[model samples]
Target: MVAKYVMLADTTRCINCKACEVACRAEWDTPLGYSRDWVKEVESVNAKGMPELQIFPGRCQHCDDAPCVEVCPTGASWKREDGIVLVDHDICSGCELCVPACPYDARWLNPVTNTISKCTFCQPRIDKGLQPACVETCVGNALIFGDANDPNSEVSILLKTKEWQRLITDEVNIGPNHYYYTAGKTIPVEVMPKLHERHLAGKSIESIVNPLGTIGIGGMMAVFLGAGVKKLVDRRKEVSEKEDNHEHH
Candidate 1:
């Protein structure tokens, strides 16, 4: 039996204390600039004349078909067999390609390792048959972690019973494991970090210019091949003309 882990977020129950964020950073010793996990505050406007704010904690989705893994040049980003997304710090080239490839704004570069880092789903505790530190420490019990692959698992059962929405775009279709449930107004896209913009538009000058090179080389090859065939045909025509001249002479 393969072991699997899933993260279930009940935004309705979330108090936005940032306990998960603190616990994750403490356990992993994550640097200042990089965060292995964090909470997002999803606020609603006072349009309904209600004086209140709704909070939503956000973290790595650990999508099944992760774009980070697909775009990583060094193969540093990889999804675990159990479904958690992680980075191989040793193999990471600190290229920042994976950083912007993620739609959830999960990936970040750790100053210490200078490699892409994101949530691991707390693999170490799961190995010891324990829930993730964040899950265990969650005061409101808003965060739930279990094997989503199993229908009987807590997360799977909650997902079926609760109203949930995955924060993602239609094109990527990563099959996000993280589920955020809320009855309040949905968060605006402007508030969320735009992680895919760089990757979609080609982040660096190198990433953009290299593809043009491939197109240029292919075009040049086609032109050269066409010119070679034309020269061959002209030579054949010249030989025939000379032979006819000799015959007529």
Candidate 2:
């Protein structure tokens, strides 16, 4: 049977030490301004009118029907048989089309590679029979990663024994694989996925390039295609020169 991987974050157990964040950065060489995973602290008043704080460790939800995959013109985004969503960096045009498509705000354009980047469930480590960096380094053991298809897997067992809720909204239901164990408590509004707004660049693409593509306007499409190609070339050259300079230092 094909393995179906899933991740569980027990909100009751997280300590907000940021160990997972640190480990992910070290593992992926993520740029200083960005991260693959994060811990969100939600402060709310409970039913008893007492202050309560819920800590949620979050990342790409790795949805079953990922909108990012559906909207990519270059097919750079894809999902593996094991359910890990990833970007094919070599093919990515850095068009940033998939960024707003994700409701969870998971995808980002990497400054170094000029490609879309997101959490991959630590595929390289998993391929070598190791846990994800974040899961392995979690200080409170709140993060769990394993094959949900395997009944004996820890995640599967947890799902069977524990009450969990996924972060979902009425407007966006993508069947996210990330689960949160909240012990039957109502999930806080702060922890839910918010509606994304298209940036100026995204709006421009939608209004101009998308319409041209749809109507098969060959000349205009070619012009837009050339611009995309030029951007990719410029980025690659920039990265190459930086690498050469680093080697000489």
Candidate 3:
């Protein structure tokens, strides 16, 4: 059977050690300031007025209907058949259009690559029949990764036997694949999914390019379209110059 990959976070067992964060950074050689994964600590008061803490390990949800894929003009963002969302760095223009499209804010522009970057579910490691770096390094065994479509897969079994919830909001419904076990309690409002405002280019596309195509009236939309064209041209020139410089050296 074709495999559908998924990740599970058992918040009940998490220790908030940030091991996953460290492992991901090391695996990807992520820049000093950026990370592909993070563990968020949510603090609140319980019914007894006692301190309550919830730790959520987060990364790209690899949504079935990914908005990142939709907003990418260069088609650099794509979803693999196995449910991994990835950036094709070779084609990415570093436009940062996909960054704001994600409700989870899981993506970022890598300083080194100058391209959109996000969690890939450790595709390279999985291809070698190994677990993701984060999963392998998890101290408390709180993270689980496997094929969700296989009835015998650990993730599939867990979903069937345990209660879980995906981060979601009324404004956006992208069908995220990441599942969190919150122990039957409602997730905190701060950590719940929220749609971020679209980038200017994305807004232009939605309001002007898509709606009017080549017939956009004299307005900020036209200005945005012109600026977009200029940016694309500049990018091509930059790449060409870089290649020429490399040849000269």
Provide the RMSD of all predictions against the true structure, rounded to 1 decimal: 3.9, 17.7, 15.5
Can you give the TM-score per candidate against the true fold?
Answer: 0.76, 0.80, 0.84
lDDT of each: 0.78, 0.90, 0.91
The C-alpha stretches of model 2 lying farther than 4 A from their native spots are: 196-249
Worst 10 residues of 3 by lDDT: 211-220
Model 3: per-residue Cα lDDT over 70-122, one tens digit each: 88998999999998999999999999988888889899998898998899999
Predicted candidate 1 versus true structure: per-residue lDDT over 1-249, tens digit per residue: 675676877877888888888888888898875667777654455777766566767778888878788878778888888988888888998888777778888878778878777888888888888888889989999999898778898888988887777766655556888777776457555434354645553455447667788889999999999999999999999999999999999
Supply candidate 3's per-residue lDDT for 172.
73
- TM-score, prediction 3: 0.84
lDDT of residue 105 for candidate 3: 89
Candidate 3 wrong stretches, greater than 4 Å = 214-249
**Most accurate candidate by TM-score:** 3
Q: lDDT tens string, model 2, 116-224? A: 9899999999999999999999988999999999999999999999988999989778889999998888888877887755657666677887987778877778899
